[model samples]
Target: MSYQALYRVWRPQRFMDLVGQEMVTKTLKNAIITHQTSHAYLFTGPRGTGKTSAAKIFAKAINCRFSKEGEPCNECETCKAITEGRLNDVIEIDAASNNGVEEIRDIRDKVKYAPTEADYKVYIIDEVHMLSTGAFNALLKTLEEPPANVVFILATTEPHKIPATIISRTQRFDFKRITAESILQRMIYILDQKNVDYDDKALKVIAKAAEGGMRDALSLLDQVISFGDNNVTLDNALLVTGSVTQESLFNYLKFVLSKDTTNALKEIQQIVEQGKDANRLIEDLINYCRDLLLYQQAPEMVSDGELGLLDDKFKELSQQINVTQLYQIIDELNKQQENMRFSSHQSIYLEVLTVKLTQLSTNSEADRVSNVDLSQIELLKQKIENLQRKVDNLSSNTVQTEKNNEPRKQVRKNTTKGQKNVKINLSQVYSVLNNATRQSLNELKQVWPDLMNMLSVTQRAIMHVSEPVAASENGVVVGFEYAFLCQKALEDQELIDTLENGLDRLIGKVPSLVLIPVENWPEIRSNYLKQRKNGAVVIADDTSEQSQDNDDQSASTQPTIIQKAEELFGTDIVEIKND
Candidate 1:
């Protein structure tokens, strides 16, 4: 016997050995047992599933000369010949090459005759959907009402292409795609029977390489066995198909997840240089990203569904990132894949995409540094700072206000006209209180610079009232002139004591400080005269004037104390109503 490949050798000689189509197998067995077999049967599914194989088995069961129960008795000479494809009564036709009406007419003429040897004559047509409409019409009449011992079996990967009228005459069976686990178990049994020394990982590679096609899995195992030299390791299987090792893809994904684009891009380049199929990489990447997104969303529970080939590291990678971020990454990569289809510079596009993804992943990091707000916020804040400076200037004590439109300089100039022989002797007075210095004088400058300017021109002894004592124990009296009300308010002893102990103390010789009311100034002497004479003063008007000092500065001092206070303080003082 010539050498047969494992799939052809172990080609499911009996219905019991077929791997993942138990439902179809059971139904066929029951039909045969119940003797309810139809005249025409249609089997449809994807390639590598047992659609064609099932048709063969049905042919064998119906034709077996010594069949027992529902199954063909393989011990008999008739059953063995049928299984070995030597039966003259059964016909197997390939519709792909014989799709013409003449070929189908030959089949139509042959079905008219009775069975040669077997009880029933079975015509098995593979890829029957490939037949033209004329061919289907030629066979339709015989298919609907076939001879008593004649049966027609049509198998196709796509049943939808067949006309409904032709389909309606036949009983249809849909074969399901086999699962990876089911394919794996079958591959294991084959390897054990062949005495093949193979790793489980190699078996997994063959199973996943099948992608639900049992024939594809067998073909992969055959190819790997030829190159694998009796040691079917993962590396051998990977090399046979120019396929990437799952570990390489997983490692690159790990580097990508770490935001280490440098290594990830390098690894992907290595993969491309190895001549691995780029489409497979994309498909695996999409699956990887989907699993990661699912695991990220719900750590406690994740169903493996169709992606059972993914290993434990894939699950770990899935749980490594947030679901939302993973989805964004996958969507971006998918868009890149679509764009790559039209671009001639696919390598450059992939490299640029990798760099951009690295930059994006940096941005996606939970600990990403916030960017500095360089323009609008800082510029508006600067403008606010300037406005704040203006507000601060209004509260400063130096900028004094005038009641009317007259400038304060003009008022000070007019008030400077005083009697030369007044004999105030301010220095001699300040000597009585021990509160007189430039330190105190600067504060006087802060509030009473105009008055101090006037007093300095006279060269009299005047002192700023920083802390002038008034009790007799100090042998001094503290007083202030009408021009220096603001200067007198600095009589804070705690501040004065701190000043006296400093390097530049404001305290000087003791002085008897007296604060004179504005009326006592030489500018308003008539008001003083009325008060001392048990009399009152009259207000001056243009029509009537009781007393007028046309050239005198002391004519207006006769106002009451409350009137003077109101005039001096103006709006700065609040007057309470007694009502």
Candidate 2:
């Protein structure tokens, strides 16, 4: 026989041998003992959490002729046949490869036949979420109502992708990720059975590196064992896992906390020279800082099993740094970690992070040195008084200039009565509205959806409730559903620029954007039309007196507006009969 991997050699033969899934195994065992097993079962969880293993164990246990206490007796021919993968009665299908309707239809056709030699015909579908939509639909009928001797076991890492109809027909079981402690104990047990001399700390490191997967832990353990010449030493495990040793992590943090940037960079250089990953080093440092925080708050609760607890040196350093400073360092490192993913120059980011961490302490020391001296207090006060006197003189001059300019502002206000009350360049928007040709607007409206699709999600959401009510060669007036939305749209300069670019792409011209509330659209249109009819160019003004004069002019022009309103709203709604 060829050399088998540790994971395959140590594959759990019985449910009791499975680690970290007590609840699922107990439930399946009870169902088998009570002879109340469902026809179909769905196992969903992260990869390597014993979903397929449990399915195989359950299949063997249910069909074993000499089953003992709901456990499969591997001595039985029926159990042995399934274990060796030579049984016609038991089938394991990889849905990733056979995820077509034709493959599923074949299963549907074969599901009608009875088991040849076993009590049941078991079908274990791995990565069942990979099945196509048509394949899933084809399997629904057979899954919902299979033969009495048939059982379907569907396993997938992502359960949310499976159709609800298929999930509803099966008894779903969600497997959780195995804990590090559980993985550690399982590795120790396997090493002990193999008579391999290993360090306990090394096993813990392997367990941490596994990230809650038993298969991954065993595979890493196998690699470390070979690297250590069958002796699983701490150094070999650290090298195999590419994990920073506890001493190196403590020394790196010590240099950072002490504000020694030179030594900190040196430590990073040493770590890089040893072929350690910068990203993994950052992650380990983050975990190390987290342990310090936990140890500071509750020393008794911090244990060696939880990603290696802080040592004496780390505990001493923890007291030197306060919680706020530690949190800031962690936050800065996390941001750097995110940036490192897209950057090829990862070492540069790491060095920058080192400098940032060292600066926190230096900045605090600088803040301490910046205290005011009592000897210079009187001099500072005198200088402040002189500054106040200069500010008062400047304020008086400003008031006098405003008073001298008041009459000129009033004269300008009278000149532009039908204009806006705010000082904005609305002449371009006004011209667009006045020369509002249907062809320009219709061209923009035709490609509005394409233009909108070019915007980001947030921009699309903000502009979804608005539409182009009026357009011209150089500007377009957009009307929004609510007043606040129009206000918000006008305030976002970036959104305006994006809209301009998008419009330029779609309509071949970058038009100025004008936003208005839909409720104010009619009044604004009426005012513009009234001003245009009076042969007046309405320039925008910010003076209050100008707004009041415009209101008075609107009241006087009601008779002309009524004639225009009759054309739009009909004579009945206009009601110009002596009113």
Highest TM-score model number: 2
* CA shift of 98, model 1, Å: 0.9
How many clashes would you count in candidate 2? Answer: 0
Give lDDT tens digits, candidate 1, residues 235-290: 87776655677677688777766778999899889988977656566656676677
Query: How good is model 1 by TM-score?
Result: 0.59
Colliding pairs, model 2: none
| Candidate 2 segments whose C-alpha is farther than 4 A from its true place | 307-309, 361-579
Best by lDDT: 2
Assess candidate 2 and give its TM-score to the true structure. Answer: 0.62
lDDT string, candidate 2, 418-481, tens digits? 3222212244456678768899889888888898899865676667778888998888888776
- Compared with the true structure, the alpha-carbon lDDT of candidate 2 equals 0.81
Q: List the lowest-lDDT window of 10 residues for candidate 2.
A: 542-551
In order of appearance, the predictions have TM-scores of: 0.59, 0.62
lDDT of 2 at 370: 54
